[model samples]
Target: MLRLDRVSAGYGRAQVLRDLSLEVKAGEILCLLGRNGAGKSTTMRAIMGLLPLMSGTIWLGERSLSALPAHEVPRAGVGYVPQGRRLFADLTVAQNLEIGLMARQSGPEVREQVLTLFPRLRDRLGQKAQTLSGGEQQMLAMARALCLRPEVLLLDEPTEGLQPSMIAAIREVITALRAEGVAVLLVEQRVDAVLEVADRVAFLENGQGGAVMSAEALRADRGLVDRYVGV
Candidate 1:
């Protein structure tokens, strides 16, 4: 339900993304794969209005999001989970989640939905985020974004550094989001992990246009993915 056309973005004179275009349809998990500094995260930043686009257009359904401010992105139906988790280390688990809901007029029911998805958070509502395990922190980061109930979810490596069990949990979460018709734009480097949940894959090449591949093709022979982004 989200599309970026001929998008070029940069910081000052240094360009990171060059004419990148891709799409994420409703209920489909589109995985963005590429080597480090391949503009994958830049694409996500541009989509979330966190980074200014030097030139291009971003759209959700019929609404144009090119000119929307960074603060309005979540309100515009796009939820973002940055690579580092970026949780408030000092804040209580519940407090961090409450911050996301403040952007909208939603009620506690939305919070409940997020809690339901990550049942582990239900009991640690009062715990400081820093004390939680790495996996738990990642779950909380994703849960905070889901509190926005976005039409399009922008996830940047939700399983970067965690145990195998956490990786499985994230995979199952992506599968569940697809079933719920939530369009997901997942930027992950772990080919095997995301392949189980991805319906399609897109490669973000540095200073070039991206190419799309069916998830099946990548699954049948993972070397196809390794060809572009490496194992």
Candidate 2:
């Protein structure tokens, strides 16, 4: 559903992604694994149009997304949850979700679908987002993105600061989304959690591409995980 071809991007002269090519198929969950500073976040930003591409192309299905503006990318069915769970601290959970709805041109059933995916959000609809715990905030972030009814979701460091149980919860949600035909491109620090949800995995190294492997291959090969992802 999403494709990046020989894409290179970075801040100013410090290029972080060097000719990185990758694809996320529709209804599939593709996880990206890399050590810190391996350009995973940069790849995500380039695809979202937050960072200007120095070279190459990004496509959503058959449409070219490389030249589109950042705001337009969301409307084109790409949703991003950045490294930190960036939520409106003072806004109620419902209000934050409502902001996301601005991206959708259709999907009247958006709220119903998202609420079903995140039931914890229902009871806290009126509560301020900042008052929630780490896990709750993460759920709110994902829920807000889902409110857009995006076809492809890009999640960066999603389970970074959550408890094990929360990680498991998020994994279940990722699996459920895939079952429902949502394409997921995830950048995760926790290899095990990502492997649990990913259909395939790619490793990023030193601002360049590394290896692409089936989730099962990565799971069975402990040495590959250690060598590429620092396990």
Q: How far is each candidate from the true structure, as Cα RMSD in Å?
A: 1.2, 1.2
In model 1, where is the ten-residue run with the lowest total lDDT?
Answer: 204-213
* Candidate 2 residue-pair clash tally: 0
Query: Which pairs clash (backbone N, Cα, C closer than 3 Å) in model 2?
Result: none
Task: Tell me the whole-model lDDT of each prediction, alpha carbons only.
Answer: 0.88, 0.89
Per-residue CA lDDT of model 1 for 1-231, tens digit only, reads 899988899888999988888889999999998888888888988888878898889999888888888888899889899999899999999999998888676689999988988999999999999999999999999999988888999999999889999888878887898899999999998888877888999987785556688899877777767678874
lDDT of 2 by residue, 18-101 (tens): 999999998999999888889989998999999999999999989999979888999898989998988999999988998888
Q: How high a TM-score does candidate 1 get? A: 0.96
TM-score per candidate? 0.96, 0.97
Clashing pairs in 1: none
